[model samples]
Target: MKFSVFLDLIISGAFVLAAFLWYLASSDNAKTRREKGDDESITKAEIFKSWIIIILLCILGLGYFFSFIGSLSL
Candidate 1:
């Protein structure tokens, strides 16, 4: 395969892995909050931050996919 294709695969895989790890971390954080009875503001902040990162990751992944498609020969 071409170098571009290989590089794209690597980057895409990295993005997928990063998103999955982020999800796991967020899940753990929520569990910790529940167990510790964290403040409402803290919980809200964590949720907001996690959502923003997840949304950004989704957008970046979609953008990369479209760009890869555009680069294809057919």
Candidate 2:
């Protein structure tokens, strides 16, 4: 495989790993907050932020995939 393809795969894998870590950390935060009897609003905000990160990642990944496909057709 070409070097470019290999680089792309590495970057994509890094993004996936980052997202997974973000999710795990967020969940742990929420759990700790619940255990402390903190306000629900704080937990909700954390969850929302997590969702936003996931959505943004998905958008970026899709954009990269489509651009790669476009390049192939050129």
Candidate 3:
């Protein structure tokens, strides 16, 4: 395949990997908090940060995909 297609695939893969890692981390964090009792809990800021990372990765992946498409039309 072409270089752009290959790059898009890589980006897509990276996004998926990042999302999975985030999910695992959040789950682990929640389990740990539960084991620690009611003294600790997840914070809004932490959730917000995770969302921000996911959003940024999604945006980057889409941007690369669009750029690949644009390149094809030129």
Q: Which candidate is the best by TM-score?
A: 1
The segments of candidate 1 whose C-alpha lies over 4 angstroms from its true place after superposition are none
lDDT of 1 by residue, 1-74 (tens): 47786566567667767777897899789889978998968887897898788878867776776666666754
Q: lDDT tens digits, residues 1-74, model 3?
A: 48766687677668767877886787677667667773443544566677788778777777776766776677
Model 2, runs deviating above 4 Å: 65-74
Give TM per candidate. 0.82, 0.76, 0.64
* lDDT at 7, model 3: 81
Overall lDDT per candidate, in order of appearance:
0.76, 0.75, 0.70
Across 1-74, the per-residue lDDT of candidate 2 in tens digits comes to 46675455556566767777888898998999999999999899889989799777766666666655655565
* Candidate 3 global Cα RMSD: 2.6
Model 3 scores worst on lDDT over the 10 consecutive residues at 38-47
Instruction: Please state the error at residue 74 of candidate 1 in Å.
Output: 5.7
Candidate numbers sorted by TM-score from highest down: 1, 2, 3
Residue 60 accuracy (lDDT) in model 1: 76
Question: What is the overall TM-score of model 3 with all chains considered together?
Answer: 0.64
**Given candidate 3, what's the lDDT at residue 20?**
72
Q: Candidates 1 and 3: which is better by lDDT?
A: 1
Show where candidate 3 strays beyond 4 Å: 38-42
